[model samples]
Target: MRLIFGLLYTLFFLGCLTTALFVVFHLLRYSLDRKVAVFGTVFFLSVFVILLFTNALIFFTLPLESLFPTFNTL
Candidate 1:
């Protein structure tokens, strides 16, 4: 039970961190580009929206029972 919850918590935090780092990488790269591609902005925004929604869903929909069988109250 503890191990399952631990793994889920780890994955949730790591996913959020990874998405944040990806956005930061894109921002830094775009800043460095002298002739930033026009479509890059659109693409970046699309990806950001997608990732944000995905993370939100993951965080909200995670099955507590799978992680903590004892706390299946919910």
Candidate 2:
């Protein structure tokens, strides 16, 4: 059902976002070069945020029927 799918989708997004955050935290905590760590964390977090937004946008805008025609029968 759509509800289940939506829940799973949200959880997946959150999981990925959290993973990205963890990576950023580790980079900032462990990296030797301060400038590189800051820059890398910013760049990586920006890319991850952009990707998450794009995916959520596409997921909401895309027609489920087009993606799975057979589901229409249900």
TM-score of each: 0.43, 0.85
lDDT of 2 at 58: 89
Candidate number achieving the greatest TM-score relative to the actual structure: 2
- Runs of candidate 2 with Cα error greater than 4 angstroms are 72-74
lDDT of 2 by residue, 1-74 (tens): 56767999989998998999899999999999999999999999888889999999988887777788887678
Our tally of clashes for model 2 stands at 0
Find the candidate with the highest lDDT and give its number.
2
List lDDT for all candidates, in order. 0.68, 0.88
